[model samples]
Target: MHSQNNDKKIIKKFNESESLVINEFDKSGIISFAQKDVSNSFLRGTSNDFIEESTLYWTMKFNKYANDFFKKLTSDKYNFNQGMLKVFKNDMYEENNSKNYLLINSADDIKEMTNCHLIPILKNIIHAPKEDMGLLAESLVHMTLLKRKFSIDQEETVGGAIVVVIISKSDGFIWKEKKQYYSNESNKHLEYVNYYKSQ
Candidate 1:
C-alpha cells in the first residue's frame, strides 16, 4: 500500500469544492416542461426535511448515463423519447393515490411507453418557472436502479437504489471503493437507465 499512497499524492492537492456542474443533460433530454403542485404541502421543497420518491444519485453511474444521454440528446437524427411521461400536479397525485395510473394516461398523451431517457426523471422534480434548487448537481451521486415493473401478477413497481460508487481522493471516481483505485477510462460508463431508449 505504500507505493499506492505515494503515487496518489497529487490527489490531495485536487480541489474538492472545485468540481464542475452542467445543465446540458436535462436540456438534451428534450423534457421541455415541468409541473409542480404547491397549493398544498405535498410538494416537498428542497429543505431536506421532506422525503419524496428519490432516485438516488452517484458519480460514476450518473456521469456515464448523463454523458451517453447527452450524446444521444444532441443527435437529432434519431427521435428519442421517454415513452409516456406521466405529469402530475403534486396535489393531484396526492389526492388520487389510488388512481395515480390515471394521471399517467392523459387524453393528450402522444405515446404509450414504459421507458425513456434520464431527463424526465429529473425535470419531473425540478421544473421551470421556479428557482432551481440545484440539489442533484451539488452532490456526487452514483446509482443503479433495479426496476420491478408492475405485472398482472404483481401490482407494484419497486426501483431499488444503489450508491455503488464512492468518489476517491486518489482516483476521481470508481464503481466502488477498494484498496487501490485508479481511474479507468473504459469502465467509467455509468448505468442509470431504467429502460433502454425504445425505438
Candidate 2:
C-alpha cells in the first residue's frame, strides 16, 4: 500500500494481487485505490453522500483500467463491453443463469457483485493449470481464458500480462496529466490541458 510523508508519495507494491497503495499524507485517509492515477473526473459525481459514489468509482476504475490496458496495444484481451464506453456512464455488468446477463447498476452493493466475478460457480474451470492443483489451476485457467477471450494477456499462458503493462503506462501518463490539471485548477475543461501545464 502507498502512503504519503510530508506530501511526498509513498508506494507499496503487491505481487500477489497486483495492487498498489497510495496515501494522502495524513496517514489514515488511506484508500484501496489501484495503481492507476485518480483524476478530477473521479470527483465528477462524488457528492455529499460519497460512500456509494466512491464505491462505484472504484469498481468502474478497475473495469476501465482492465479494459484500457488490453485496448491500447490492440491486444485481444479487450473485453467486448469496453467498446460500449461511448454510450454509458459505466461499463460493469454481471450474468445470472445461462442466456441472461444482468447489468449491475448498484455500485456500492458489494454483495450483489457485478456478477462477473462468479466464475467458479457459473462455469466449471477444471482443467486450467497443468502445473498446479486442479482448483487453483482451473481457476487460473478460467481467468486466463477470460483474459484470452478478452484479448488481454497474449503471447503466454498468463492471459493478461500485456494488459497490465498497458495500464501502467497509461496510468503514468494520466498522473502526469493530472498534475498539470491541478497546477491550474481554475480553467474550464475545454482547454485545461494546455493552460494547466503553464502554471
Candidate 2 wrong stretches, greater than 4 Å: 1-105, 114-133, 142-146, 149-199
TM-score of each: 0.16, 0.17
Once model 1 is optimally superposed onto the true structure by TM-score, how far is the C-alpha of residue 72 displaced, in angstroms? 54
Q: What TM-score should be assigned to candidate 2?
A: 0.17
Which candidate wins on lDDT?
Answer: 2
> What lDDT tens digits, residue by residue, belong to model 2 across residues 1-199?
1111211111111111212212223222112232211211121222212433444355446556756754563555554565465333222322221211211323224323322333232233233322232233234344544544665434333443322111122122222212342323444553644666578
lDDT for model 2, please. Answer: 0.31
Residue range 1-199, candidate 1, lDDT tens digits: 0122321232222211112211345442211111111111111222111211121122224435645655565466666552321222334334433332322232112111111223254456445421122233112111111112423544333344433443434435644424334434543542222124232
Show model 1 residue runs off by greater than 4 Å: 1-173, 177-180, 183-199
Among all windows of ten consecutive residues in candidate 1, which has the lowest summed lDDT? 31-40
For candidate 1, the lDDT comes to 0.28
* lDDT to native, each model: 0.28, 0.31
